[model samples]
Target: MTSRFMLIFAAISGFIFVALGAFGAHVLSKTMGAVEMGWIQTGLEYQAFHTLAILGLAVAMQRRISIWFY
Candidate 1:
């Protein structure tokens, strides 16, 4: 994907990551057990990692410094 698209995707993903994290902590926490909560946490962590990776890729692409790597 292009750098612009990657940046937009990363922004959206980051937004979802934060939203889901808050939802899990404030809303789901009341109903879910520790194990379920842990699962949510794990998923959010992965989402966060990927979001950052996408952001990095977008920056690299924009700078034209890591095109070959991508």
Candidate 2:
């Protein structure tokens, strides 16, 4: 159940990140300067990477592992 929830959350976050990226590229480009757009792009990239990392961690956590390995 927890794994399912985590997967769903990850999907939602990934979708949001894509939407934000598209918005920044198409809509914000008109109003924002190149430097500002670069920052926004960086932020979106970080967010997307973190979201995927969280998804990976959740999957790892669901697996059985020896305490000594940690």
Candidate 3:
């Protein structure tokens, strides 16, 4: 997979991450219990973090960084 594709994928996932979080906060808050909402928020946090990490790596790759230790 190319770095461009990875970066684009990361960008799209980031948008999705925000949309889902907003949806959960505004829509699910009324229907879901506190515990469920908390879990959803936690999952979103984790997803955001991983996606950002991937984005960073993609940027690094695009810049031709020597990160791969192998």
Candidate 4:
């Protein structure tokens, strides 16, 4: 159950990840200040780390817990 939840969570996060990257680059780049954009970038980096960690957990569960965990 946890594995399934993580997989779905990761998928949603991945979508948001791409959307945010595009938004930050194309939209925020023009309107925002450098320091504000830097902070946004930092937060995005942290979010990427956590999303990847969730993906990793899903992979681990597939291998270690059960092949059908997903």
lDDT string for model 2 (23-45, tens) is 98889999999899999989998
Clashes of each: 0, 0, 0, 0
Model 3 TM-score on a 0 to 1 scale: 0.92
RMSD of 2: 2.8
Model 3 per-residue lDDT tens digits across residues 1-70? 7799989999999999999999998899999998999899999999899899989888888989889641
lDDT string for model 1 (1-70, tens) is 7999999999999999999999999999999999999999999999999999999999998988846666
Better-scoring candidate (TM-score), 2 or 4: 4
TM-score versus the correct structure, for each prediction = 0.94, 0.80, 0.92, 0.83
What shift in Å separates residue 58 of candidate 2 from its native position after superposition? Answer: 2.5
Mind giving the per-residue lDDT tens digits that candidate 4 earns over 1-70? 6778889999999889889989999998999999999998998998899999899988788667554544
Candidate 1 deviant stretches above 4 angstroms: none
Better of 1 and 3 by TM-score: 1
**Model 3 segments beyond 4 Å from truth?**
none
Q: Which model is ahead, 1 or 3, in terms of lDDT?
A: 1
CA RMSD for every model?
1.0, 2.8, 1.3, 4.1
Better of 3 and 4 by lDDT: 3
Superposed model 4: Cα runs more than 4 Å off: 65-70
